[model samples]
Target: MTPATENPWAFFDRLYCISLRDRTDRRERARIEFSHMGIEMRVEFVLVDKDHNDPCRGIFASHLLCMKKAIDAGARQWVVFEDDVVFHRYDPHILKDAVTHLSNGSTWTLLFFGCLIKGSSKTGNPRVKRIRYQALAHAYAVNRAFGEKILSQPWCGVPYDTMLRELSDDYLGTTPFFAFQSNAKTDNEACLGLDRFRRCFGGLGLIQLMNEFFHAHRLWVILGHLAVLTGLGVCIW
Candidate 1:
């Protein structure tokens, strides 16, 4: 994993891709996609069995395995990506930049390449931002310190991304998304889970939508839209 540049901290020496043994098609797809992005690496397949039937548990177990492997390999930090992840614009420089940035300290528990998160005050660095929520685990990097912390915890049955989110407020995400899951393709749709809210009228659905909406818009933009809507309603009345 050598970077094209002379920078000492440019590329991640240890990178792992988690794939399901049963999903050979996805495995092949991931291999090709990662290769295209110059991420030539080995895939860590997590075979499904009776004990790992639960998708959440399977994800958690796979991540834990990755962490252990990193520790055994004597890697100070490692990058992990799900098989379905698609690199945004497929640039090697961006990935290298993230590797360099997040490698700065052990306090940065996780640096998400792609996620659904509430926007927060921008950090001076464009490559990182404060993450308020993390809904996806498509791509991320963690250091040895965080890996040790993860190993110390018991399996709480929570989803892997949610567990990682609760572990620390130090989680950061790359703006403009370094990578994301390939959801537009039909073959890739199986990994997409049911929406958190099945019905908009349901209390959870409304809350989820509001949260997403508010997080996406700036305060002034939201207020301006509200005023325009109110004026339209009055004019119609």
Candidate 2:
């Protein structure tokens, strides 16, 4: 058992990080970050190979697999992180204080270090707060029962964060997020036919064009061009 004075993170049975097989760079970053936080020994890496068809499904499968692994390992409290995770505000007692104020996580179903707030959320304690829904499963903690509960359900696909939120009746999260997704190439993007086209076009051009034009003027110019083309087509017809 972790001593009462120890940080709440000490109570976690293990910390697992999910990374793609090719992302050793991400793995090393986690290693250095964990060592900085003095928790390197607790982290275990789960390497996943991306599925050519869909990476999101691969992400979902990896998370489920982590839950199963934790349960099998008899982990009572555990944390899961994606390779892109970056820790923020590292101190011995910052997170400890939040956990302590929340009755030391006695009522926690899911505890998130990184999550996106939705409309259904209500504001209260920033240190430790209740949340209706959570997204961005970059970093989150789970108890043994919580892990088991998630595993028991019939689930599929990515957007795994939202799925957990729907299943979780009692969830808690940190405000000013304790973790963040690093500004790196996203591994979970599934580029399908139309999506690939959209991405290609979206990133292809027009930084200067967007900067030069006001929103309304841009719209008007586009409309004017369309009208001229329509008139020419009508004349030709």
Candidate 3:
């Protein structure tokens, strides 16, 4: 009898309707191209009503749903991303190698697949573990154990990156987290600037609000997005 093939990753994509409105064709082509490269990835469009009043809620809702779906798929190890981020043209094997490295070597609750920094700084940077933060959910990898841990906790009502910062001290070198630094400046598509929120609250306070929101709402902060979008728009329904 033939042996059953090992289940590939239960990949999750933290997509937004903006992708559909902005770049539908490129997105579809990218998905197909990645698949052809032998990366068993799946895109889960975290739909939120374009009319959902608060854009922040829509964005967060998408990620929360994406996390839940990844867990429901029985994903032990999964990669999460926003549709805006682009991948390197390098061989697919190289990408897979990086994923394997993070998966096996670190206990990082979340591994940034891409980073968008300008110069070199010693702040929370990884050497052998390189993927630095350049954009929002550019690409993050997670394990089922970690996924369950984060999911079980309330959504911290803040961007995922900041959320990691608070938890970073807890898992310093113990968790092998990284960010991609090479294509930080040149790669526009790969970077995530969150133009929407920037237009609304143009100041550092927005970040502060996010952090405070996460602290206050905790899980509900995260879960609120799920309900807001799911109710306002179509999602993991």
Per-candidate TM-scores read 0.77, 0.73, 0.51
Q: Relative to the unseen true structure, what is the C-alpha lDDT of residue 180 in candidate 1, on a scale of 0 to 100?
A: 64
RMSD of 1: 5.3
lDDT of 1 by residue, 1-237 (tens): 433364323345577887767777877888887777655554454443323456667678888888888888887877888877776544555655555565554257777776777665466665556778657777887778888898676788787777877887777766546576664332223243443222323432234344444665668777999999999999999
**Which stretches of model 3 miss by more than 4 angstroms?**
1-26, 32-36, 40-46, 102-105, 117-127, 130-135, 153-157, 169-237
Look at candidate 1 and give me any clashing residue pairs.
none
Q: Considering every candidate listed, which one attains the maximal lDDT?
A: 2
Q: Against the hidden true structure, what lDDT does model 2 obtain?
A: 0.69
In model 1, state the lDDT of residue 84: 78
Candidate 3 lDDT over residue span 30-84, tens digit each: 5653465345244554443432354444455555566687777666666655544
Tens digits of per-residue lDDT, candidate 2, 1-237, equal 343487567777878999889988889998887787777888899988997677667777888889999999888878998877777665556567556654544556777776555422333544656655535688888878889888886656545766786785577766535576665556555545534453454421222123223231556778999999999999999
Candidate 1 matches the true fold with a TM-score of 0.77
State each model's CA lDDT, in order.
0.65, 0.69, 0.44
Lowest summed lDDT window (length 10), candidate 3: 172-181
- Which candidate wins on TM-score? 1
